[model samples]
Target chain A: MKLASATLMLSAARVEAERLGVIVCVSVVDAAGYPVAFLRMDGLALGCIDVCIKKARTAALFHMDSADFARVACPGGGAYSLELTNGGLTSFGGGLAVRDRNGVVVGGIGVSGASTEDDIAIGLVGLAALS
Target chain B: MKLASATLMLSAARVEAERLGVIVCVSVVDAAGYPVAFLRMDGLALGCIDVCIKKARTAALFHMDSADFARVACPGGGAYSLELTNGGLTSFGGGLAVRDRNGVVVGGIGVSGASTEDDIAIGLVGLAALS
Candidate 1:
């Protein structure tokens, strides 16, 4: 996604986060798992910053929601231990891939700070802004 | 620095990179060595993503340009082998500290995906934008 669009999405996510009473770190990455834009809200935990970026990268690189990837990476699953292989993949609820109108994967969004469900919800809100 | 200001710096760096006809990855980190923003231009090498972040983190954590850190970390120097101590420090050009008017370091910036000299020049341009 273009940087301007990515920044718009991030702004949308930030609004959602404020409504939810949470301070979080958000990241957007292109299809190749490279960052397009990132934001760490004031007062957020420093650790969440990197985690947010990695989550976005994991979604973009895998072309799937991190929650779904978590299921596949669970013990006894075909992709067990996959998270350990790529720098550090985040197979959690907060990461989501962004798709174009034609369903082509364009980028990804990752949100961190709140509960898993809230993170996922915020990420979805961010992706929705892209549409 | 705030994410907004960091994004401005990244934008300035992108303009410089475009003028040089080189694609690059840029990263900004807060005083605690946590990412505030990042961007990788389209078609740039994917490998530079993590490297750019690390470089920024290194600069922020050490409060010095990566090139100067290189001199200190070189073999026979007082801080030899220091690069391997952190997660992985990049002791080279392209990483620089960002200080506020009070002379306090607010953050750091790192640029990658070009020759060392070009990367350093681009990072400097980015820093200059903050002023």
Candidate 2:
């Protein structure tokens, strides 16, 4: 993804998190799962930082929301143990593939430091900023 | 480091790399060694991405240029085998500690995808942008 797009996603996520009265870390990665932009709000727990990046990579690498990927990677699921690969992956909420104007997946955004539902909500807000 | 400062550094590095006629990956990290911003320019080799991050981390962790750290980490040197202690580290040129106006170390910038000398030069340009 272009740096302009990644910065917009990160800014949108930060605004949504602030509006929700919670601190969070957000990460954006290109289609190849390399970091493009990242922000760790002043009050976010340090441990959640890497989780945010992994979630974005999980979405970018798999071309789906991390939560959706989780369903397929769960025990007895078709892609069980898939997280073990790709350095590491976070198969959970808060990650969403970002698509371009043509609906082509170009990157991903991830949010952490809130409940799964909130993280997902914040990430969706970021994704919306792109379109 | 604040996101604004990190963004400035990344932008400066990009401009320098463009002027030098090279594609590069640049990374900025906070004092604690967490990534702040990163950009892998179009055409940058994928292999250099992580190296860029590691270089930033090495500078942030040691509060010195990675090239300077390399001198100490070399075989039979004081910091021999130190790179293995951190998740990993790049003890070579291309990474430099970033300081605030007060001369207080705040973060670091790292560049990759060019000769070590060019990488260091680009990173230095990034550091200059902050001042």
Candidate 3:
């Protein structure tokens, strides 16, 4: 396992998203859910920025992706939650964890784009660039 | 004067959707954003459930749809701003208002699933069923 900069990883995700013809908002954060770097594409619907960040944070803190949280957390129910249905967290796929070279889960990356699968794939490839 | 059965309007909208091969989530609300009648199609994503509600709320409460609010709310903006991009309110095109026969603007409806245009179309047709 080698090491890479979180900042660099964040930018790489952005680049990859552009290459894929998808405009996305990407978030990189520590295991605690605090942001490392965040970026949202132009015309990316200003509303998506924070949602991506929060989902990334949720994934990092809970050590599970946002959808997983949404699965466990039903409407008006759960221990760890995807309560964003109230509007702050989007559990609609797209969020994933970012692990370091040591095989340790270092942080998480979340993306919002064309579709749920596209967002998740963008995050994985973006993190891969850092590795 | 005659009347529109709230339940009937809801059912008609669902029927129309079935004819179109689109499973949709529909929300009918009073002017206050409270549910007059709400229904989520089988297999509709759970996160989108509340999103339609609040977007309907935002459309009714502020007298504007979620997209309109997002246009005004900034990155970390204000009190009257559209704050849900952080996750609660989806400004994405699935929300609209429903006025009464008296033209008093009594309520609103929101639809989600498929594209933005499709979502809005479902809501409009749903509202039209009441007329």
DockQ-best of 1 and 2: 1
What lDDT score is found at residue B114 in candidate 1?
Answer: 98
For residues B30-130, could you state the per-residue lDDT of candidate 2 as single tens digits? 99999999998875544467778878888999899987877766455586767555776765678899988887889889897787789999999998887
Which regions in candidate 2 have their CA more than 4 angstroms from the true location? A1-131
Residue range with the least summed lDDT across 10 consecutive positions in model 3 chain A = A79-88
TM-score of 1: 0.52
Question: Who is ahead in lDDT, 2 or 3?
Answer: 2
lDDT of 1 by residue, B1-131 (tens): 89889999999999999999999999999988889999999999999998888888878866678888788554434333345434667978889989899877788999999999999999999999999
List where candidate 1 sits over 4 angstroms from the true fold: B1-131
lDDT of each: 0.83, 0.83, 0.64
- Model 2, position B92, has a per-residue lDDT of 68
Give the C-alpha miss distance for residue B20 in model 3, angstroms: 28
> Could you tell me how far off, in angstroms, the CA of residue B57 lies in candidate 1 after the best superposition?
14
Docking class for candidate 3: incorrect
DockQ, each predicted model: 0.03, 0.02, 0.12
Across residues A9-34, which tens digit of lDDT does each residue of candidate 2 receive? 88998999999999999999998888
Each model's backbone clash number: 0, 0, 8
Cα lDDT tens digits for candidate 3, A1-131? 12246667667778778888988888888876777777778646444566578768767766677667656554333543344333345444567777766766777788864456678778777777775
